[model samples]
Target: MKGIDQAMNTLPCQGCKGLCCGPVPITGKEFKKIQKKVKTFPRKIRERLERQPRFFGTCIFYDIEQDQCGIHDVRPEICRAFGYHKELVCFRKPELATKEKISFKESPVGYLSIDFTWKDF
Candidate 1:
């Protein structure tokens, strides 16, 4: 998960920064969402994480060992939000980020060019 900590290079699940590593404050609603995923309530999860405070880390569902999650397919909403910040989308399947845009043209050439070309910097 390169976006896990903004790492330019991708990392293996086991090499990942763990599920709860960094500064990510959680609201009451967010807390409830996390509880639902972890199968625990807010009261029990109020304590700081083993390595860092809860306010400064990723979701508890993130698996540091495999660098993956035991509940990735059914992760909480907050985790979903992490993959999309503003207009930037970090799609894991594609392994890259994509900027959003609206265009009048969808293709060119045969069907219209699906490929995009831009001048180099």
Candidate 2:
């Protein structure tokens, strides 16, 4: 199936580094599907996924050299959902654009926090 990145026509991801390729949460079924295509899951990656079965760190499939998803065709659903969407607030935080880690929290009371962390992944 075509991932959302292709469906949305977000080719090249202009003006933005591959920040979206950071830690992403996915369903157990999705992980199983991904495992079939990806071999040699790192210990750190496996631990993280064990702790939070839904979390996939640094998208093991991302091709840093190409600056795009290596497995774009069967990438996790969470990866597919990300992009220049209206509900995303990360784009506004330009300073954190090139960082290794990006996180956002939104509350019902109109409060938002964007944090960046330097993780090994």
Candidate 3:
């Protein structure tokens, strides 16, 4: 049995399909919305794509082979905004390397404390 530290450390996202980083095969309009919001409007952004309908081909920045993002330094804002802030969404939430040891979950709704009752003495 693995504890949270080990379970969290072996997270499969880097090796598994990176659904979060992909262009998401967005509709033309949705792509436009993302492009508009993420900056680099129309032509400039369009030029980066393999086809007008495809968001820079069927690939994400994450180098699946290496289990990491290839261009993480230049990753988009949306990717950066995937998680929450100043709040814990779940008990197993990833530990933020930046913040103090503040974690949470969505069990008791708005805000809840950890349920330590499950632990055996």
- Which one wins on TM-score? 2
Worst 10 residues of 2 by lDDT: 109-118
Clashes of 1: 10
Tens digits of per-residue lDDT for model 1 on 1-121? Answer: 6575666543233444543322333344444444465454243332222233222335444444445653455543434444334332333423433424323222212110011111100
Clashes of each: 10, 0, 1
30-118 per-residue lDDT for model 3 (tens digits):
33343344344354433333122212332433444455554345443333434333332222345433333333221221100021100
- Assess candidate 1 and give its lDDT: 0.36
Task: Rank candidates by lDDT, best first.
Answer: 2, 1, 3
Candidate 2 Cα misplacement greater than 4 A, ranges: 1-17, 39-57, 89-121
Question: Candidate 1: misplaced stretches above 4 Å?
Answer: 1-15, 18-21, 40-59, 70-78, 83-95, 99-121
Which ranges in model 3 have alpha carbons more than 4 Å from their true place? Answer: 1-12, 24-58, 85-121
Query: What lDDT does candidate 1 reach at residue 113?
Result: 9
The Cα local distance difference test for each model comes to: 0.36, 0.45, 0.35
